[model samples]
Target: MLWAGSKGGLEVRTSAGGATVLRGRFPYAVPTVLKDGRERLREVFEARAFAASVAAGGDIHLLVHHDFDRPLASRGAGSLEISDGDDALTFEATIAPEMRGVSYVADFLGTLSAGLVGGISPGFRVAEGGALVKRDSEGLLRVVRSAELIEISAVTKPAYPQAQIEARNWTPCTAAEDRTLVHALNRWRL
Candidate 1:
């Protein structure tokens, strides 16, 4: 399983016309802990691990909590743009007002604007021979060298603590509404 870092590197911008743009960085080279049964392991993505996958230009989606059914934007639709950076995968997604009309989507947007969404994470599958495990001073270390990037998501909890989000030009939810949305989002985990 793949684990994402903490929530601190996301930004959301809404246009006067109601188009919401979500931008964030999915960082590499940050170590996160993963568990396989009773064994604990340290995992980190090498810099540029996602370069080939992003360069391939495959269709990818911006989702909430990694839910396929809750996609907010898609690369194939020209609404999601991804770029491979030196140490992270950066993405910008333009969400139309029409798309936000979907019940869950609207809720997500509101929660995001209210600063309840945690951070962004990448959903990916490691390629063959793309990861190497070695013994380190801390214990077992898994270095991911390559992977197929499938999707990016806004999550309520993160394992890595380097991601962040910001909302601009958007109306924030009321305190009562924020509380309710937070309750709802906490229950909708993956």
Candidate 2:
């Protein structure tokens, strides 16, 4: 998963049950974390067909680092859909009580609303092994590859600087990704 999100042009609002909502644009270009521990961007653009596939399932999820186990909530309880608008992929997510334990998500939204988080990252899946292309830092791909569709999530720290910016004041990192922890205490009162 690529790290992204920071301060600027982000609108966050708290709804019933303390659910935080926000809409933002993320890159369509997919990146892979190879088993050998190398990362590279893929050239195959996931514009509409990918969005259509996820929309068809209508079960997009709100997660951190593309970690399914760390899902804060599901799109079904709210709305998580992607639209390809002018080569830009925009998504809107509504996190509900189902994400009660994930307080950092609230904080992320709060910081984002305050223009603290300024980037969006793609949370996707790809086949274990396939004829994939190798892309350079400039996103120049050579060969063939494919990535499966999944949910796009909001992250406090982005792996790629171009992908998203990390807020200097926001220090909640590991705690933000602990999906297994049962957060009974509500930190965000927004």
Best by TM-score: 1
For model 2, how does the per-residue alpha-carbon lDDT over 34-57 read when each residue is reduced to its tens digit? 122243333334444245445466
State the lDDT of candidate 1 residue by residue for 1-190, as single tens digits. 2335348778888899989988888787777655433455667778888898799998988889877789999999999999997778888999998987799998998888788886887766554477788876667777778766777889887754673222111122234543231322232122
Error of 2 at 80 (Å): 2.3
User: Candidate 1, 106: how far from true, in Å?
Assistant: 0.8
Report RMSD (Å) for each prediction in the order shown.
Answer: 11.5, 10.3
Model 1 / residue 103 / CA error / Å: 0.4
Quote the lDDT for 19 in model 1.
Answer: 94
Each model's TM-score? 0.80, 0.52
lDDT values for all models: 0.71, 0.46
The weakest ten consecutive residues by lDDT in model 2 span 165-174
Model 1 ranges off by over 4 Å:
1-6, 35-40, 163-190
